[model samples]
Target chain A: MPAAVDVGELVERARRGQPRAIARLLSLVEDGHPQLREIAAALTPHTGHARVIGLTGPPGVGKSTSTSMLVSALRRAGRRVGVLAVDPSSPFSGGALLGDRIRMTEHAVDAGVFIRSMATRGHLGGLSVATPQALRVLDGAGFDDVLIETVGVGQSEIDIVRLADTTVLLLAPGMGDGVQAAKAGVLEVADVFVVNKADRDGADATVRELRQAVAFGHREAGGPPWRQPIVRTVASRGEGAGDVLRALDEHAEWLADSGESRRRRAARAVGEIEAIALHRLRGELAGVGGGRLTELAERVVDRAVDPFTAADELLTNLHTT
Target chain B: MPAAVDVGELVERARRGQPRAIARLLSLVEDGHPQLREIAAALTPHTGHARVIGLTGPPGVGKSTSTSMLVSALRRAGRRVGVLAVDPSSPFSGGALLGDRIRMTEHAVDAGVFIRSMATRGHLGGLSVATPQALRVLDGAGFDDVLIETVGVGQSEIDIVRLADTTVLLLAPGMGDGVQAAKAGVLEVADVFVVNKADRDGADATVRELRQAVAFGHREAGGPPWRQPIVRTVASRGEGAGDVLRALDEHAEWLADSGESRRRRAARAVGEIEAIALHRLRGELAGVGGGRLTELAERVVDRAVDPFTAADELLTNLHTT
Candidate 1:
């Protein structure tokens, strides 16, 4: 595809809000192509401004409905939005899954919204590397808001959630991870908690439990001063998405007042810089990296040296060569 | 603590099979102390010989009992054993959780059996970096077998499982992730599938479903020729642990003949080398690292330059300095 398609032209079109151009750019990111560095350099100047929101929770808690509701609400507010619905659990990837497309059909021709689902299928540095780069693409392409929705099951989900400026955790009445996910320390990253399926049987119980958990968490807290708000929603009927949006606005205000917005972005940038640099360094030090890896690996098996010393030797060679 | 004790002498004691010394050595690794490189250098020669077993699955599936069962079985065969029960699911680490301590009380008096639980509490590099080093400590200390047990909820567990030569995935009758976990592609990492709580009503059904999944998985497979064996165990009563032990020996023998063991260890070494080199390189490039981070981060945020260019400049400074 690169033999014919000019990456520079793609970037130009993507910046002008061409959905196909933006999709191609994301495909390149997901593919972990050799041209990624060039793409990133071209896209950088226009980035660093999108309001990244992370929406995550365990499986089957109406994440898609809530995401769609938020999308509709954001569109009504007249903001250009981009969503990367990522399923890190699946080891395979081709492109946007049918489920993602179906849930998002209403906005297919809106021109104000863009949605993409990332599959890990042979992603070079895994989702951690691909996600930040994709976020860059969306942020650069003139989107005012970017939403990252994940199936919130693993450490990768945790890492992706931290990339956002604000996180909203969704729960249903009888899901497995009501307080369980919070206990795993994901609660610290959540700015708002939504008990979706609020019209269901145990909605009140779920909300009450979540409120108690939130209060208990803050009782001995030492980090931020903003108390998290728990909102009840029946996203299928679009009941309380407005309240969720209002909560996001209020939280954004708190972030600015506390100087946490600047701190979060700075920390996020450092993390991105660190991941990219380490990935590139790994490449340069490993025959260019792979072939050299074989020789070094053989030597270690032969007890010629340990991994630490071999890594030192690899670094030494890098410094000299 | 370092000024009060000699690392060299401690290494000597640990290598002599002193449990306290081994515990202290692991503490240093868990703390990501500055002495890790020296410790690795010292432990390298005596390492490379222990059989590593990874035991993992979802929570409440009797991992502790299985680990304890395996410990007794290995000791009965006259092999010194080590167990590192890692809880990556927990954000707080205060050493061994009381539940972990309680589960293995039977082996507490056996000098030949050692068990430790890892909490993530401020682990400098996380379990991925710490597990291999901790494995080295046990292996170098003359333990013939080292077992890594994890709650198996996330990506961290998958990484830890790969560090071992053989991985045993335990599943109960009606746990959250039965075939669902298999679908997420943890099926490939598994060498033996143990359906614990075999006396439960759904045991036969789970085994039958797992067999079908395994057969389906291998239909188009091109890697190792080993068909994964499914073993059923009521771990709480120590009923089927012997069968699991026999399965381990069979797998070990197969690994010896298949050359997969050599390849797996070499790959493991390559990963460890990559991690260490990146850690050291990131340190050098970032200003001794953190202070340099703040200045570069500000520039990226101010749009003075993008993160890619900033990372490149950081690398350039690293080479020149």
Candidate 2:
């Protein structure tokens, strides 16, 4: 538990766009400090205003470079922006070059832009719990737009799709990333696709392949009918960033008209609440005498009872205890 | 709920190696039929004898081919084998192209072999619930070896490593798979690394890179000193299959000698029990009037209370109800 702090003052300062206060609040969330509940309470009113966007793709698809370009484009439109670069790998390794931070230094002096890199300290569900709270903090701080950047590799990274209102999957030419994305089930989560480094030799081919893949990757029969557009960009030279912005705007509008944004946010809330609830339940179960549970497990192993029955008995004992 | 099943008779037949009875038991588990509890109760005494192995790797890495060859080798060694090839993709998609089934035909008619393919139908944690129960059925049926095969592309697939006593991670040359494996954090989960397609060009390089990666991927300080072995196998020709088997035997010996096997199985039991318990809790939460949870969420959204506090209220209300 953390010492009692003036959460109200922190919230006020953050609401007034004080970067240090906002950073402190986010740190509290990331560290799972006891003040987090107070911070969440404070920030609740100012959330749901920012349009959260997720950017992900296979490694080396210039995800960071494209994210930087997206930031510039959003800032040009006079919208305050925040970026979260998520490293899906374990934090213990600690060699995260975070090369993207170098690319993002252009916005280092801008008060309207915030960038942070997040890593999981190998705790299960660590990223899932922290990322959303950080987003809320940024949203409460009045960032009109928040961009989440992550490497699209494993299951944990796939979680970013749930947090973002719109997910952009980036790929480059000649990487056979389209197939890899499908295998990873990432293709199904994409709201929009981008072929970065379009000036490269295989840009057109990549775009064509993505278009074809997206065709077969259609949602359910009665989905919004918003065709996932594939745009090509050369993020290095800042070309076609505006097109991505336009696509985002179009998706945002579709989300609004289709009433999907509310549903997505509601679903996200339900998932988070359930996860927290489950975590608490696990804690309660752990506090139960290990000998009792092991005895029941041994009974199940010895053919005296089924696992479901053992589980039922355990739960019953848990509640009574 | 299903009709009252003659669980005692079914168990007796399955114990006598009746394939139909075994199939019926597995089906009950997968479908969550009411008879499942009875079946589990009947089979509990016959469990914990079979050696469970997990085979996983990226796409195009000859995972299926290698699994097939491994099954053949085990059969020749007079071991009855069971395979569960899990497809993590949604069942609604209907494009699994599990073409590997064709390659497995060589053993299709072998009375000593059993193979089954499973899909999730997009239910979260569906595979987790079903896989273990099916393993129990096979184990109770007197199978000497059970091989669980899955495409290692997502987070859910990673759970397979926890379920198996020994996990074999397959890779091939020239795919930059070593680096990808490291990036995906698969290097850490591997107990045995197999370079499939050992005859391919760059096979030696892949093997060397894997050795280096495993050397560096040492487990936490003062943990088990088990060094992961890297083996090369050309599964198409059944080459090096014996070596892979030898490695598995070595790992099995190590697991038994160090008391790691019991600890692993106990941990696995605890995890499964917790997951099932959580699922029940989620169901209870869902059964709560949706409007109540939504109102609480709205209050959180409006900054009236933190989510934790709201969750606490919900749990209290649930207990009272």
Candidate 3:
């Protein structure tokens, strides 16, 4: 086991914009370390600062490239940015994540940019459970913006990735992304739609289809509906990066002006607290009754006790600290 | 509000293989009824009698068609079959599920078959949580076989679908499925590989690539590792279904002989029990301290309390009955 460290001291260093401190905090969250509760307690007050931008789309849509381009643009705006590339691909293959990291090497040395690739492995509840805590670490560290770039082909995966201040759904030309996006049910959560690789064939067609879809889908209730703008970009050549950035800024403004920012942040906090509690309950239940869960499972298989009763027994007296 | 269901009476009817009773029980599980605990307790004693076979593949791979063919084949052998087509596709779009139901219309009227399409919505843990309970209902209803066919595009989604006694990973000709399946990290969970649409061009190539990939990947550590068999089938034409069934039976024998069946079932039971406990806890927490979770979330947003502390307060005295 790693030696115990002072979480308060780490948080203090992190608040001062120390890279090592932020990295350590993120590792703790990713590793599901025992000190997480303490880290959250220390970091919570300093959070609620970063503008979280989630970039998601189907595979081969250049999500990583778009994220890298955004990071460069955000740095140029003199903003400290953090990037968490949540890989939703096969856990057995690290090739995509490896390729993503290589593509992000240009910003690796820039102090204003912090880039990390997160694999969805061993984290029960998948990306949602781990990403929120990691996002908190960046928020607590005083980053001006945190970009969560994930492979967002799956519907449930897209819902999990919607825990962001501004979610930008990226699509590429001729990928047949409009119908694909509708099929993935991602059009509902996206605040901004980005059509990357705009120089490619059928870029206009993709954008036109997306525009039609946006107009067709019902917007969220109440306060003036901020129309989702579709931005065109060739992220590989760093073209239209400024346009994407402008859209993001405009969305962020709409968010604050319409009071959607407050609602989104609060909803995010609710999800975060609930997820943390669930994670803790799971840990506690696993170790309860001196290894009861496994024994209960055995009994359940033997027909000695029903699973519901077994679950009830496990849940009883699962006291919180 | 729906009338309170009679749990014991329903179980008795379900065990007698009454279609209406079985459908009602499945509806309860899908709806996350408050009487789920009662339903589970009533159903547990009759479970463990069915063979669960899961068919999963990427979109456009014809999982639903394969499932329909397998259902007809199983019915011919005098085994009652139940199919749960769990849709992980866009929640807003029911087109795929509708298409699947239409294809299974022949089996819909068969007294020996039960077919249902499950949307992965309103279920917090997505397909995994809702599916296990649904499987149990079928098992208790005296079905000799339960086949779960789902779109397994994402890696985490595949892990959730592995709650089967034998998992069949489907591939198609000329879809570049070999690399795509590997990329989805699906190669690890497959017990048998089925190359559907075998009459199409590149069928031999797909099969050859899958054989090579299977040979390269490490098997689960155990006695006499089962070499995953590749079965070719034209599901749409109802050809080669018997070959796939034979492969399934062979794998089932291997599983029982290797005692891996016991392990997988026990592991699946553990996950089921835990998911039930978590779902119940979430319900209780949402009402705890008279909506204290929302209040705590508001406080966290206002920087009045750290999330960890709020989570602790919400978890405190959350007594499970």
Candidate 4:
């Protein structure tokens, strides 16, 4: 069993803007150790203070650069920001490489900005297992804004929309088409659509295609009330970053006015708690019966009997024993 | 509530090659209706008859073409084949378009060939809730071989390899150097690597790069007993299909001789059953409490409290009630 973690101390240290404590707390939660639950329960009240935004797209779409530019722009607007750049988990070690953090050295020394690279840590959904808890910590730590950058637009990636007030889908010029976007499942969730690397060829065509795609799918002629703005940005040069920020601000306002923001936040809270519960149940179940599950599984595989029946018997045993 | 299904009758109809019954059985398992447990129990005794293979790669890597060609080749070899092409779920209805089956229409008339397309169905791991159960049904129906063709390579795609007796990774020409192969999580899982679209530029380079990448990763000079053969093919033209089949045959022999085949199948069976159990439990939980779980989830988003604690409380209530 893992050692018990001190929830209060970790929260206090994180609130004081200690990066290491924040990282450690996130690690504890991502690992799904029993103690992380206590820490998350304590941190819940601290969330809802920071405006969280999500950035997602296919790999090699310049998501990291876009995030850096967005952070710089938010700082220019006089807001303290926290960034969580999530990398895909390693299949072998089930850990993340955290490679994207190497690209964001510009904000490391700025006290107004806190940047951290989180790995999925084998969470089924693309978000970090402890993301909601970590967001709460950042909220209590007094960050005015939080930006979550995901590696790809998998189902897990869509989970970001639930956690963020606004989600920006980043696309690169000369990449895929509207069908590809639909396939990635990004068009449905994005509040803002950005064609990054706008200086590249086909930028206008890609933007037009995205607009048409959105128009075709929108229920109303004027488009959904959120108005997913398609902005062109050369993130590498920080060009058009202001427009992205403006779009985000406008969307934030829309969210507040429509009262959907509060509802989404509540839904996100429930999802986070459910995720934690599932994680814990999986762990606890794996530990029961002195690992008899493995033996029974093998027996089922050996054709001694069927797995469904085996599982039923196990559940029955759990009930009676 | 969905209507209860008859497992034995459905299985018997599917065994007689009734497409509607097969489709209905698949839907029942996919939706996690309570009857799936009974259906799976009935089908378990009939599995272990099909030689399951997994095909996976990045988008536009010619996975569909390769799968089509492979099915054709297997048919020519006098084998009854079943193909399950896994596509992303439709966002609107959460159903698959079943496009792959349409693409392979030539095989539709052939009684020996059965093709089905499965959607991820909201599972984060990319496998549908009913995949394993569906595979079992197909197997029980007397398919000499079953091929699981995944549309994209994500974490969930890796799960396909664990389910198959032999796993093939398809790579398109000009998809970057062998480093791209390594980075895409294909290098570790593939038993056979195919440099598809041989007519395209960089086909030779891709093959050479893959050879070098495999060499660098292999600790032993002989290549880990199961050497990943790099086969070049223009799957559209059905070129090099013979060599691919021969390579598969050799790999199957190798696996059997080394006892890896039995071990892999056993592991796959356990995993399939566990996944089915988890799927069933999720559905059961979703159906309880008059959907209060979903409502509480909304409350969590509203910031009433943290999700971790809420989930635990919900699970506790579920267990007690």
DockQ of all predictions against the true structure, Cα-based? 0.37, 0.33, 0.43, 0.36
lDDT at A233 for candidate 4?
96
Best candidate, DockQ? 3
Global Cα lDDT for candidate 4? 0.69
| C-alpha root-mean-square deviation, each candidate | 4.0, 4.0, 3.7, 4.2
lDDT of 3 by residue, A146-240 (tens): 98876665644675667888989888776532235334466778888988888989889888978887888778678888899999988989999
Weakest lDDT window of 10 consecutive positions for candidate 3 chain B: B89-98
lDDT per residue, candidate 2, B1-321, as tens digits? 567788899888988888888888888888877676677777878889999998877655677778888999999999999887774422111223345346778887898998876654443446667788888999999999998876554455677567889988888887652236333555677789899888899999988877777777857334468899899999999999999999999999988887777767776676666666666767787787356788776666555766777778778866777
How does candidate 3 score on lDDT? 0.77
lDDT of 4 by residue, A126-237 (tens): 3435677667767767789998876443455566545788888888776542136234466777788999989999898888978987886553123237668899999999
Candidate fnat values, all: 0.42, 0.27, 0.44, 0.30
Write candidate 1's Cα lDDT for B199-272 as tens digits. Answer: 99888898887888788775313445888999999888989978999999999988888888888898788877
Tell how far residue B309 is off in model 3, in angstroms: 1.5
Model 1 chain A poorest ten-residue lDDT run: A89-98
Show the lowest summed lDDT stretch of 10 residues, model 4 chain B: B89-98
* Count of backbone clashes, every candidate in sequence: 2, 0, 0, 8
lDDT of each: 0.77, 0.75, 0.77, 0.69
